[model samples]
Target: MTRLWNDPQEFVDEMVEGFVLANQGYVRRVRGGVTRSTASPEPEVSLVIGGGSGHYPAFAGLVGPGLAHGAAMGNLFASPSSTQVESVVRASDRGRGVLLSYGNYAGDVLNFTAAQDAVRADGIDCRTVLVTDDIFSAAPDSRATRRGIAGDLTVFKTAGAAAAAAYDLDDVERVAILTNDRTRSMGVAFTGCTLPGADEPLFSVPEGRMAIGLGIHGEPGIDETDIPSADGLAELFVEHLLADAEIPEGVDPATARVVPILNGLGSVKTEELFVVFRSLVKRLGERGVTLVDPQVGEFCTSFDMAGASLTLLWLDDELERLWTAPADTPAFRRGVVPTGAGVSASDAPSAAAAAAITDLDAEGQRDDAGADVPDSSAESRQTATRIAGLLRLVSDTVSENAAEWGRLDSVAGDGDHGIGMQRGATAALEAAESAERAGAGARTLLTRAAAAWADRAGGTSGALWGVILRSLASELSDETVPSAGDIVVGAVRGRDSVMSVGGAAVGDKTMIDALVPFTEALDAAVSGGASLADAWQDAADAAERGAESTTGLVARLGRAKTHGDRAAGSPDPGAVSFAALARAVANTLKNDTEEES
Candidate 1:
């Protein structure tokens, strides 16, 4: 399915307009959507670059005082025309000359070469340097012809420094080429990116498998392999770059140094990136390479692909100095600003000082050492067990109804919601049981259970469940006993928190339909001084009625949005699940209270 866009051309044009507006003070938009550095208007040399959109902070994003002077922006995954490149060159021209630096691709080379001829004819001196550092892009024998990857950052830094230091255009071109030669990068993608107006992904990878050496524009990779653990993936990526860069095969006992860059493609989390970094450092040390000045984060991305790339730039004194130079841009900033030179290692906090300052137990209460701290009260244990039972029921219900829900989602949604809900419910039940066994408080048990559920089951429903439970736990912070009034207050606060965070309401065809009425009825019954059991029964009945009403309403949000009118006459599964949970809570409360009395 194609994506919905006003028009691809207009979309690209408007985006360029916004980018130029945001960077106007620091950089100026030259002809053809190329941005030129405003700080170095008359540098001894100038660097002109160009590339496709979506790979932000690459060609255009690297334009600044200490990077490329100008960049010709292209359409997403499409090359810019020769004329467009020439226009950018003319706009960035200085008396000294201009250097063209770009990835090694046939289309880019052909276009940039034509632009170079045109610029030379206009009496502006210009030269070109191609970056080919992707080891997977070409055979080892033809590595010089490979496409550039994350190593583009190293190339820009080197060339930018050369230009800023008053090197002529030729000198800057040489520096860029040298950096490209010394750098190498490789990446793997678990999933492909989606280009605007394109329903189908730009490329495809088999589920539970990854494409090694995948191109940013959806091109086929060298091989497909079963997905590895984060640590394993890190080792594979590091091995590829190190081999290509020809880091010495044997470890030197003394004076071995290297710089490692761990980059996220787009959608990977910072936590995952750090995990990869930890593994990479361990492997590098084993190889006798001392990591110096490591840069780890999303320096480059391929839209929202779920993957990462590793780039290694062998650092020398000159390269290291240039890499450490003061440079600031929207996405990257680093410099050698001095700090606290006199601070010694002994002045840092000792291990004993870092120990807990309070004698509070995990539940945030005094430990009272040698005194018998009470286990969870019988009422609290019952409440926790009821929650665990409810979660188990929901998990079973979801598994049984998976086929029906999957059929509904097949038409418009991803068909994973049922599975996601089942997984989350299972996790919640497990957490609740564990917390109860540990004698945790009501609030702590609920919070821990919810966090476990959300972390184990990714997606919208998991997040919403986490919010609801977290809000409920927060409301019960000081209450030792949960009366019907306390339940109503917690439910109301939880409902409000979900609405505020998710921007959904009673008629949004979301779980809010059942949740809103359940909380409202509970509040009303409690305010009228009904018994706790009676109030819970009333709220459960209202929740059931609200959930049933959703059968006639068309879904207007989330994956259901694509169903349009077809979603009508079918109750939202989220609302149904919420109603089921409300009823379960009411029944549990009544039975437990009767037993206690």
Candidate 2:
């Protein structure tokens, strides 16, 4: 349990601030995260790596001369928003292009890809290499879908080394991809971790049992067995890693040289890791595998998690050379890194804090207002005010049901859906209210709200909700009144766009399950000449049914997909939240009609 924190929401921010104060020699604070405090002799291809916070040393602690040029830090167990990613990329970009690398989680993929496209629009060359090294997240043939774990160091080291060597964007990307292909990791947990202010851990295992294939974000393991002795546990690791299906392609363990990293998740001590490493190294030697510079300590971590993971990087000549290259970072350091003609920390340029999506004053008053909004007509402004009211209602509804949604998500996910939805919905309402105060139109209000939701929420749901609203906003006109048919068309566009962006189908057990049925029912009702309120109520009812039906289905997408079986008896939190939002909107519409009558 995290005992020391002023506020749970402010934990990550405070941690970053303290980290920079302590390591000013290596890194400087930036808007989204940290960047190097010193400059290289000349611009090399910038290596920007990041993911959620709590995995310290992985992201911010790795930013320095020979590692990451910058890191885009997100909330606890959440991916950073696209706005955050863009900020770090802009600050890190020199004359050379930038290479974005991070774990292969759904939120990170959505946000990072969006940032890549945004920077490219400004004529900056940017590329991405997702770290997919967790062996248990997906089958060997489905490696692309696997999540990254402790093996992140191997890929980051290789890419950063290549960049430090003055490799172009193409070669840097190539080596990063090749490194990801050669790295494999597996993790086990003795107990789950608790987030700050949470009364319980995300998930728990029975006493004397150990979980296998657990994620770093407190996600419950996929399988469990009785805890084994140190030697027995090492045997388990060797047996699984040496299996033919688990080895990297073209690498024969009998004659291959590999770098083995034994990483402590959080609470596991260095002594325990050494104990495990002793048996692990002996087992590998028996099979004729040559171990390279073996590492045993914390690299990537889950806050307070009682667990560890082992990573292997199959080495060839080029990989071996890069793996041993001299580099210095706050966390991982190699042999002496030569001093370059780099600028000192005192002379380096500083960046202003990034504009927050959900801002607050020093006294904790809301500060998401005061932005200048777009122009609108009187009739459209009336609709915008009504939209603001509807958003307020939606925000309240989500807040009321957040705990239940979180419980559902914890069955198979990292259990932050409720927090994310709350953030997105609140930010959306704040943006809509601010837009309405400036006499904006419905389209302008929705557009602002959509951007805020995506930026504040910073997850798969956030990205999807932003897409839904932006698509709907595009169909509305500031000068004309919106009809029921127009709204239905917008909803259809939103639904289709979400399906395309998220790559999920109707039966994938995501929010699409509820969204599809609601859209279809609303369209059918509106086309039959029903009033907007009547049509919406009917659609909301259909959405409720759709959400309930997910309890019998298995998840085929997102974080839940890895533990699909565990999620079989529970409805997807995303689908449930969507249904709840639809019902809330329906109630607001119905109330407005009754008041008018």
Candidate 3:
């Protein structure tokens, strides 16, 4: 359990500040995360790596000369916003391009891709590498769907070392991909972890049982069984990893050198890791596998999860060379690294100005209020005012049912959905009200609301909501009043964007379940010549039915996907929230039409 923190929400920011202060010799504080304090001697590709907080030595601790050039830190178990990722990348990039790498989670994928596109617009060449090496997360054929775990160590090391060797952007990306292909990991947890200020852990195992294939973000595992002996656990890992088809094909276990990393998730003691590794070595030896430079410690971690994972990286010639290359960082180090004294700072000019965080971060994409807002007519401005009021209504509705939604999510997923919804809804309302006061049009007002919500929410749902609103905003014209047909088109665009980014269809037990039906009903009604208010009412009813359907479907994505049977009876929290929001918006439309009549 995490007992020390002022505010749970502010924990990541405070930790980043303190970490930079303590590692001033190695790194400097930046807006998104940390960058190397001392400049590198030669210009090399900046290796930017990041993910959610609670994983120590993974993100900020790895930023230095030979490892990551910068780290974009996020909130606990949530991906950093695109704003943060872009800020850190801008600060880290030198004349050479940048390589962004992280675990292949949904929020991280969306945020990092957004950052990549954002930086590319500024003429900086940037690429991305997603670590997908957890052996038990997905089947052999669906390797891309697997989550990253302790295997992150070898991939990062290979990429960082390749960058340190002054490899060009293409080669750096190639090696990182190669390393990802050769690594595999499997994890189990004896107990779950508690977020700071939370009274309970995200999910718990029975006293004598353990969860298998658990995620780093406190997600309950896919399966549970009675706890076994150290040897049994070691055998379990060996069986899964060695059986993986992706394990470097035709590599002779006798001649092939492997780097075995035994990573303790959090509360698991170092001694226990050593004990498990002891049995692990015997099993590997029996299989004629040669373990080289074996590491046993906490590489990546959950808050206080009593669990550990085993990762195996099969080494080839180039991989072996890069694996042994000189490296240095706050948490990880290899050969000797200079103290940055003799080397002139002119070698690497800093872009820290762009990376500086401010109170404006809370404003998110809304900071661009004066940037590219289209002109709006008086009639459109009136609609914007109505939209602001509707946003407030949605906020109130979400707040009223926040605790209930949270309780439902706790049964299968991390219990943050309700809080995340409340944060987004509240932020959206605030941004909309501000835009209304500023005489903004409907498009600008809703777009700013989307940005504010995504920034404050900070999760998978937050990013999706941003995409939805942005899509809808793009379809709206500020210069003219929108028609019922226009509303249907915008809503359809919003639904498609959510489905595309989230990769969850209607039955995936996500927000798409409600969103798709709502859009479908609206489109049908509009095509049949129904009024906007009447169509919205029908759409809201369809959304309610869609939300109810989720109670019979198992989740296929997000943290809840792995909680087999645990979430069987409850409707997905996302779908439920979307349905409620749809109803609230329907009421607003009805009220608006009545006023006009």
Structural similarity to truth (TM-score) of each candidate: 0.54, 0.93, 0.89
In order, the Cα lDDT scores of the candidates are 0.67, 0.86, 0.83
Question: What range of 10 consecutive residues in model 1 has the weakest lDDT sum?
Answer: 357-366
Q: How good is model 3 by TM-score?
A: 0.89
Off by over 4 Å in 1: 1-5, 244-256, 336-597
lDDT of 2 at 381: 88
lDDT for each residue of candidate 1 in 1-597, tens digit (9 for 90 to 100): 235457542555667777778876545664454645354523457778776566786667777667676787655544454545666676666567888887775446655776688668756788888887777766667766687777888888788778877887777877787777677788888887765544455456788999898666545456789999989998897677666334533423245666678888877887898998999888888777777789887776777778888887776677777777766555566663222222124322123321211111122221223322235666665666566676676666666665555344433333334544655566666776667666666766777667655533434565577778877776553226566677677788888877875667888777899989888888999999988777888999999999899888887765455343556877777777777767876787788778989
- State which candidate, 1 or 2, has the greater lDDT: 2
**lDDT per residue as tens, model 2, 433-540:** 877777779998888888888877777898899999888898887777899999999999999999988899888999999999999999999999999999999999
Candidate 1 accuracy as TM-score: 0.54
Query: In candidate 3, where is summed lDDT lowest over 10 consecutive residues?
Result: 351-360
What's the candidate order when arranged by decreasing lDDT? 2, 3, 1
Q: What's the lDDT for candidate 3?
A: 0.83
Separate clash counts for every candidate: 4, 0, 0
* By TM-score: ranked, best first: 2, 3, 1
